[model samples]
Structures are given as structure tokens and as C-alpha cells.
Target: METTKRGKVPLYLWMLLGFAAGLGGGLYVNLTGQVVIPEVMEIIRSVGQIFLRLLFMLVLPLLFSALAVGVAEMGDLKSLGRVGYKTLLFTVMVSAIAVGIGLGMVNVFRPGDGVDPLLAQQLLAQGAEGASAIVGSAPQSIEAGQFFLDMIPSNVVTAASENQILPVMVFALIFGIGMVMAKSRATDQLQETLQGVFEVMMKLINLVIKLAPIAIAALMFNLAAVFGWDLLVRLGAYALVAVGAMAIHMFIVYPLLVWIFGGMNPLKFAAGVKEPFVVAFSTASSNATLPIAIKAAEENLKLPKRISRFVLTVGATANQNGTALFEGVTVLFLAQFFGIELSVGQQLIVMLVCILGGIGTAGVPAGSLPVIALILVMVGVPAEGIGLILGVDRFLDMCRTTLNVTGDLVAATVVSRGETDAVVPVDEPLPAVAPPD
Candidate 1:
């Protein structure tokens, strides 16, 4: 019931309170060995589910509208080409580096060796039925050429309905390109409408974000009430390794990029990004935090509106450095847990899959789980091993999402720096205004 000057609790405080209460409640339940009624737990979980669903509902519309407008706003073919190439190249290279770091950390730490086999087996058994259902529906194998082909949806409506993000992205990109090429009055009008829709979607996101504190509290409480401390103890090393890799990427890698490529002070870059980072960490959704990230880049970071719009919007959908890193660490941890000794080639394939999966991953909570499960199966590791990390994933999701948004902002800054036309002068006025208008 604590309220800030605005008469509502600040979001960060709300999330912190939720997390603390959940942790306390969970520990109490575990120590006392009291059974929470299943029905009551279900109600709590339902609140969290509703929150997740609300966020998911916005993903497609937000992606399409933002991407389309961002792309169309690029104006001409040549400018679009230059910006697109730099943005994507930077995104892919950074994401690949993140995966490399994850692979290296997991290999060195070998968190799987610390996990008790009996505990792993028990965890596997407990979630076997759900895991089986996941594997039963998973693709038998992923083909390289087919992956590209599948991205071109036969029916975009079907893709949106089923939440096939990659295909939807492909559709948006093509639609945006067409709009740019047409260069007609109607096309301009449509682009304006899409931009308006993008703004509306952001407003809706702000509305839904108000529910986050209670929803996150319910989620954490449910997780604690159901799983307890034993699982955390067992997977502590694996969790540490995953989190540590993300930390390295965030604290070390990103700053280095800002200082080196962006020619900006790393400390200043970090300071500028604080607002978006908090929203991203608390919500665990890059798409949900897109509007704030854009605002930060333009206002605090002084990135050009053109570059920030294109890079950050596309990055929200495709450049998932943190998710890529987590998937790499996760796949390796599960492989080690099951005594699956992957060859060098297999490890490289795992790296590739994770990088690609990160690009396609939706910017929502636990969005990487299904992709992780699929990679596990492709590597002949038990898809059921997903059960091992599910308990700790929500917390890790928060960490990785922070990295994801940070990486996007870094890409925007670095890429903007490279474009002479796109770099706003450091001494430029914050809100440029005509003096005599």
C-alpha cells in the first residue's frame, strides 16, 4: 500500500516488494512443509497467466506496426539498404559473440558435473508427461534451407494466429519494403496509419504494465510455493553459470562496444540506458519495453531518431543476444547432465541453432523455452531435460531480457555512430525548436 508522490507505488518498488514477499512466502512454506491447496495455487498462477497473455496479445501488432513504420520511414532504397546492412551485421556479430561467451563459460564451469544425477532423474520424472507432449509435437529435424523457406508464410493471418513470430517478421519486412517502393500517396497514408497504430500499441503496453507488480508477485509466489528450495540448490551452479555469462555480456562486452565502436563513454552509455533497463528487467519483455528504449536512445543517448527507430525496432524482434547466450549455456548444461558428450561439430551446431533461435525469439517471458527444448531434441539430448531448468528460468528470464534490451541500445548507438548522417551532434539541443516560430 506504499505510494510514491504519484499516488501509486513506483514500478521498481512494486517489483522488488513482489519478489521479496514471494521469496519469504516460499521459504516459509518450504520450511513448514505445509501443503498449499492446489485450487488456491491455480488461482495465483492464473493471474500470472493472464498477465503473460495480455503481453502476448500485443506482440504481433506491436512488431508489425513498429517494424513496418520503422522500415517505411527509411524513405529511399539506398538509405534503407545502408542502414539495414549495418544494423543486421552488427546484430548478428554481437549475438554470435554472446553465444560464444556462453559456450565458453558453460564448457569451463561444467555446471552439469555439479548436478546430482538422482536429482536430475527425479526432476525428469516429475515433468515427464509434459515433456513428452512437447517432444511429440516438435519437429524431427531442422533443415537449413527449409528454415528460410518456412519463414515465408503462406498465410500471414495463420502465422499471426499461431504466433509464428519469424514468419510474421518476414511478412512485415516484405510489406514494409513494398510500402517504401510504392512511394505513392496511398502508401504514405498507410504508413502514417501504421505509425499511429504503433503509438496506440505502446499506450496499451503502458496500461498493461500497471498490472505487472501484482502479476509478477503472483508468478513468483506460485513458483516458490510449487518448487521450493531443493530445486534451486540442485541447479545452483547451472543458474550461476547462465547468469554469469549474461553479466559478462552486459557489464563487459556491451560497454567495450560502446567505448570502442560508438566512441562514447561507457559510463555515460550505462547511465543513459538505466530507465529502459529497469522496465525490461521487471517486465522480462523486450517488445514491452520498446517505447521506453526508443525514448532513451533519442533523448538521453542523443541517437538519431532515424537510426534508433530502425535499429531498436528491428533489434527488439531479431537481435536477442542475451537469449542466445542463455540457450547456449542451457543446451550444454542439459547435455552434460545427461552424460551426452557432444563432438566439436555438435557444439558448433548448438551455437548456430541458439543464435538463429535468438533472432526469432519473441520478446516475452519464457519465450525461449520451446526453442531450447527443440535444440535439446536435435542434439539427441532428452527434451525432457527442459524440466531441469524450468523452475529457475523465470528469474533468469529477467536477467537475460535486461541484456537483450541493452544490446539493442548498444547496436543503435554503435551503428548510429558509423553513419555520418545519422549521428546527432553531442551539443545539439535536446528538443530542437525553431526560435521565432
Candidate 2:
């Protein structure tokens, strides 16, 4: 979890203050028909843009390093045997379901729609330069065959330069897989270096996020200034949909998986995970809650240490069902907000990226921001539109993070099922290993 370093006020509180202030200012301009000074407005927009550009600058390095290290950390899958294969499969399936739920909810609710077309056009105009560049760069029509072919970047550097996110991610996954296959002192050193890179990127992201309150205030002021009270209505609807989707996945999908596959009663499973769930929600960070989660799995849930440790540790980074869901909904919602209609093929592409992104996204507060930003650009949505959702993100972050942590436990339980030695009684001492002879 990100602590409120250097300030007494919690970051979330600061962010909410920024949101309230910006919303009030925007509402004043809208209700009173007061004209905002052109220069002042320009300055506000510039602040938001600078913050956004910083995020864009970090996307490739953060994505590549975080993803490669996450994969390599899984170690040799062959050695892991059934536990490894099952966990990997479970991660993918659950993530796919998560993204499916998010996309489905957005499609049904269409909260991003129903905005005034004139206001939508105005929003586009404000972000015209960057939006135009993104739109111009994306292929006019994304065909199925060509899209699959494009996943393998002909030149990784060129793909990265062009912000071809899918190709770049594919390269990182393959590179990480190669590292896993060829384990040696050299590979170990490389993994350590990549881990170091990921840690540095995370720290950099934390620093950048300190500016979020100011940036969000500016972004919201710009948005509310133009869109008026209607912006508030749309934002409320978007939040409702996001929270609603997460609720269903949390209460419904996860429980069902636990009941059927893990042979654990829903009540028992819920009772066992309460500690981790509370810690996860309060901290809003999977990384921060990992130790508690591991403890809950072994002592509370009575899961075998080996399965619990491996699954929860890997799941901390690579099994982010909640992040995947949030990214999917956010992307599709933005596309709808900007009046861009994505084809079925395009939506599927979004799904795939969200699933892959779930695995690669960092397990910290605001970790999903860069991934969401890049996805918006990929789908021809104005990345600037992200500001529209920043106000509500802290609350949503907490909610989705709860789901992420709980999902890890669920994965552990299901993976542990059918193993002959699934649990070691909490009261019983484990067999000791002899010292190296």
C-alpha cells in the first residue's frame, strides 16, 4: 500500500478534496454561466496534460519490466508440476470471467452514453491534438487475422515506439518464458535486475501519483466546466456500474468457484478469508496485504503451506482479476463517452489486453492507471477522458483491490483441492528438514 508520505492528510482524502473543489468550481461556471479566463483554463489543462504525459512516459518501461519479472518469478513451471499448471489456468479463466463481467455491464448500462453530443464534441476538441494523433496512428480497421498477426512485433523497439501495447506485452511474456526455461546463475542475475527495474518503476509511479490530487482537480475542472452538471450525473452512473460489476464478481463468481471446485462451503470460505479481505480493503493494495493473505490461507483456511505460498505470492502480481475487470469497463466506458463505437472484434481485443494486463499490472494503489491510459489510446478514445473517472477512483480502487486479494485466496483454495496433502493442521508441527550435510 502507498503510505501518505510527507503529509499528514491521507492521499485519498486529499484526492476527494481536489474532486470536491473542482466539481464546485465547474458547477459554478456551468450554473452561473461565468466565463473562465482563457489563460487560466489553459494553465489548468496544461497541468493535467503534464501529469498525463508523465504516466505515458513510464508505460512501456513499467509494463515491460513488471510483466517480465512477474512471469519469471513463477519459476520453472515443469518443476511446479500440477500446482503450477492449475494456478496458471485458474488465473486466466478467472481473469477472462472478470473482464467479461465488466464489459458486459458497461455494454448493458451504457453509462458513458446519453451525454449531450455537443458536449462530447467539445471534449474531443479540447483534447484534439493528442486524440487526433492516437486515432491517426491506430489502424483504420482492425481485422481479425491482421490483429492476431500484429501481436508478434516484427521489431520490438518499433512496436514500443508506436505504442503497440499488445505486441510489446507479447514480447515481454515470451522473454520472461525464456528466462524461466533457461535457469542459471546468469538468468538468476537477470531476474534480479528485472525485479529491481520493476521496483524502481513502482517507486516512480508512487512519486507521480502524489501529483494526482492536483492533476485530478485540474482535469475535473476542465471537464465539469465544459460538460456542466451533466458530467456529475454521468460520473455517478459510471461509478455505480463499476462497483456493481465488481460486487457481482465478488459475491457471485468467486463464491461459485470456491463452492464447486474447492469443495469448500461458501460460508466457510468467506469466514476464513475475512481477515485478508479486511486488510485488503483497508489498505487497497494486494502487495501490502500479502502476508496477511498467506497467513489466512494457512492458519485460517487450513490450506497447505506450499500451495498457499506459491499461489498467493504469484497471484499478488499475476492474477489480478479485479484490475482486469476495471480496465475493461473503463476502456469501454471511455470509448462510449467519446461516441466511439468499437466493433465486436475491437471489444475482444480489449478483453485480451485486459486479461494480459491483469497479470502484469502492479499490485499497488493506482497501479492500474498506466494500463488504463494506454488501453484508451489503443482503442482511439481520448486518453484525456480518463480525468473524468479520476475523482471516484480511490473508492473504486479500494473495492476492486478487495476483490483482487480475495481472488488470490480463491485461486489458492481451488488449486489445493484434490491434492492428497492439501492441509497441515494448524496445531500440528511440520516435519523438519535436516541441515545441509
Candidate 3:
């Protein structure tokens, strides 16, 4: 029943409490140092699995309506084109910074060396098995130019059905571009439909976010009851580096970007950005956070509705700096853990994969982790290292989401200031929380 500064029991608090519960469970397990009961573990895992499935079930509809509405808000291709380019460019650059920081720290600190050799062997063996599970996997070992061709949506509905967000986004961009070409009357009709769908989705999203604390509590308890928190220690420096690098990227790198790029005061931007920031951090879905972000940008920051609608929507899809960086660092760190040396060629592959992952990874909770896992596997890294980070993923995901939206808002604000009609309102309302669809 606790509330945050903006009001209500914020979503991140629920998840954090869950994390704390899990940590406690972990501590008890480690202290006893006893064999964990298999039956109990299975029950916990089952519950966690159910919760995960619930979370996944919510992704498609939420994304489809929200993202489509987000795109449609742009009104025309010229605005869409400009916002899309800037958003993508900024996300790519920041994502590169994140991954570079992660890879650099992991390498410099040698975080993954000397992990239990047995754990390494077991994980490597398991990782290969995991790789075999990829049936219709995205292509690998392809020429660089081919990646661009492949990124286009060969089938938009298929992309949507599969919840393949990157391709869905690509389709949305093209669709929006085409919408802009149509007459304004037709566009308005389409926009109205999309908006209605979005409004309904927003209501759903708000409902789900309300349950966030419970979900977080459940997840944390299950984690504690089973694997426990001490597993993080086994990761040693790798864990430290991963969390540290992400923190630096989120709190430092992002705020700096806002200040430098927008000429806005860092503290003010950070303060003003909280409502959207908390939602992004809690839901870990910039896509989910889109409605509130647009509202905040337009209503609070007084950004022109056209600009807010345009830039914020594109930012949801293309401006994913956090995912990019997370992919970059995790892939390299996994390679280090498995003792696979990443040559210059491999590093280039890593960079390329991170860029693509940044573009492709969704804003959903722990969403990027799965896609990023696939990216690591493509580069000959052990994917099981993913499990090492998976337990903490929900928490880190919150942080990544914060960076993602903050970057977006900063982009919106900076872009708006350049326009003559852009206005900054002194009164920014608290974020709207209806339900998670």
C-alpha cells in the first residue's frame, strides 16, 4: 500500500520487495548449505513459470496496439522520418556505450575467469543443447550487408504473431509512412481506431502494473525458495561488472546525454522525468510506458502534441540504447566465462549483434534477455551464462527500461526546443496507471 513521490504503490517497489524476499531465501539456503529439496524446487519453478507465461501472454496485444498507436501519432512521414532517425541514432550510440562499458569492465576486471570449472563444463554442455533448440532461428554467419535486407518484414502479420518486435516495428514504420501519404481524413480515421485500441490497451496495462508488486513478490519468493541470491556470488566479478556497468549506463550515461544533447539541466531533467522513469523501470517496457510518456511529454513538458506523439512513439521502438549496451557486454562476458576468445572479427560480430539486438529487443520485462541470449549463442558464446543473469534480470530490466524512456523523453524535449511552437509547462501531472493489458 506504500506510495512513491508521484503517488500510488509504484511498480518497481513491488518488484524490489520481491527481490529482497528472494535474497532472504537465498541467504537462508547458503547459510544452511544443505541440499535443496527437489519437490519444493519444482513447485517454485512451476509457479515462476506460470507467472512468466502470464507476463509473456500479455506482450503481443499490448505491443500491437500501443506501438501501432505510437507510430500513427506521428501524423506524417516527414515528422516520422526525422524523429525515427534521431531516436535510432541516439539509442544506437548509447547502447554502444553500454556494451562497450560492460565489455571493457568485464575484460579489464576478468570477471568470469576461474568460475567453478565444473559449472563451466556443465553450462557449456547445456548451452550447446540450448543452441539446438533454435529451429527457425535467424540467420548467422551472414555478410554484413545482408543483415539490412533481412531486417525488413517479409511478413508483417507473421512478425506480429511471433511477437518479433523489431520486425513489427519495421512494419509499423512502413505502415505509418504509407498512412502519411494518404489523405488527412483517412489518416484521422485510422488514427482514431489506433487511438481507441491504444486507450483500451492502456487501461489493461494499468491493471497489470497494479499487480506488479504481487508478481514481483511471487518471483522473488520463488527465486529465494529455489536458487537463492548467493548464486550471484558464484558469478564473482562478472556479476559485479554486469550490474555496475548497467548502473553507470542508466544513471550516468543517460542523464549526461539528456543534459548535453538537450541543453537541459541534469537534475531538472532527472527530476521532471521521474513519472515516466519509474514506469519504464517498473514495467521494463518502453512500449508499455509509451502512453504515459507521451502524456508526460505533451501535457507536462508542454511539447507540441504532434512532436510528442511523433518522437515518443518512434523512441519506443528505435531508441533502445540500454538493450544495445546490455547485449554488447553480456555477449563478451559470456565468451570470457566459457574461455572462448573473441577475436577482432568476433568483436565486430559482437558489435553488429548488439546493434541489431538493440534494434530488436523489446521493452517488455526480461524481454531483451531472451533476444540477447540468442545473440550470444550466434557469436559462439555459451548461452547458459544467460541463466546466471536471468535471476536478477527482472530487476536489471527495470533499470534498463528507465534508461530507455529517459533517453526518449530527452530526445523529445531537445527536439521540441528547436521548434518555435514547443512549450515547456510548469505543471507536469503525475503519470496515469490504469492497468497492464
* TM-score against native, each model: 0.60, 0.93, 0.60
**Against the true structure, whose TM-score is highest?**
2
Tell me how many clashing residue pairs each candidate has. 0, 0, 15
Write candidate 3's Cα lDDT for 1-437 as tens digits: 11345766555566566656655665576467766677875565445444434434554454455445444543445444455445545555666776777777767777656555664565466445535443124334446576566558788777655555455555655665566567478777987786566566545544544554444444444434333343455455555676788788767876777677777787776667678888877667788788989888766676767666777777776567666666676777667666676765556556755655554444344445445555565566644345455445555666667777877887787766665444435597666889989
Give the TM-score comparing model 3 with the true structure, all chains together: 0.60
Clashing pairs in 2: none
lDDT of 2: 0.85
Instruction: Please give the CA lDDT of all the candidate structures.
Output: 0.72, 0.85, 0.60
Q: Measured by TM-score, how close is model 2 to the native structure? A: 0.93
Candidate 2 residue-wise lDDT at 309: 92
